[model samples]
Target: MKASAFVLLLISGLPAAAIAQPNTAQGELLRRGELTGSRPSAKAQMQAASRPANHASDPAQQHLLQTDINLAQARAEELPNLYERFMATTRDERRTWTAPQWDAAGEVLARLNQRYEQVRTDLPLDDRLRVRSLQGEFHTLRGARNVKEKLE
Candidate 1:
């Protein structure tokens, strides 16, 4: 019954409501807001008008990928080292990271994941396993941190 939980519940039900009650006014609104296939709905303009603009004044918001190293350029051989470095900072310096900072870290993690996808076969078995392990740990820590933050 928490406000956040209630909001989450309402948001989750929107797609179902859109399909289940297409004729209802609420469902009509939801359908208008949804993206249809590769194209947006005809009411996309109206939905866009109702949406608020983003606030990107924070440094973290401006620069989402803030890994110390050039993660985007890291090769397959360096995947383990780069992942280890980022994970270490996430555990240490990033312990106090706000949502925006974590967002940047997530971007870096995603970049690493993309690189891994491209060069996974070229990487040694140990390196591949290490990269995957780091990826899993990153998600686990992020989720745990989110829970901890919510509880606090």
Candidate 2:
């Protein structure tokens, strides 16, 4: 048993070492171009993005776009429909999303919740219930994706 465990550890360490080395595509710390500096900070990125003078809407330019989930047109009467649309669009796309994409989705979901709060009093009882159910469905999709990735 000891010999077998040693062989297994040896086999595993090779791949782990290879993966640990920094590559061009991904790593904990990526250099900035050929300057040997670290990756641009969030503030640096925002400054770079807002640098274009021809673009008058600086706020619009600064907003991060990750997924296609849009709830801007949602109202009290249309909250359920909007939530359903969000669920449908995100169901398959979340599986392939990276960490940044997931963060963006979470930001959008928080915004949706804010909208719900603004119009909750105006929403009918059944529609409100449906909206809650749709939110639950979105969470379920996230849970399943996590489980699938863990299994893989």
> Any runs in candidate 2 off by more than 4 Å, and if so which?
1-74
Using TM-score as the measure, the top candidate is 1
**Model 2 per-residue lDDT tens digits across residues 48-113:** 344322321223212322233334435578666666665666775776877566555554444455
Candidate 2 vs. true structure, TM-score: 0.49
Worst 10 residues of 1 by lDDT: 27-36
**Predicted structure 1, TM vs. truth:** 0.54
* Candidate 1: tens digits of C-alpha lDDT, residues 8-94: 999999999767632312212222212112233557445534633332243432343333445435567877777787677778755
Listed in order, each prediction's TM-score against the native is 0.54, 0.49
Determine the backbone clash count of candidate 2. Answer: 0
Cα displacement (angstroms), candidate 2, residue 127, comes to 0.6
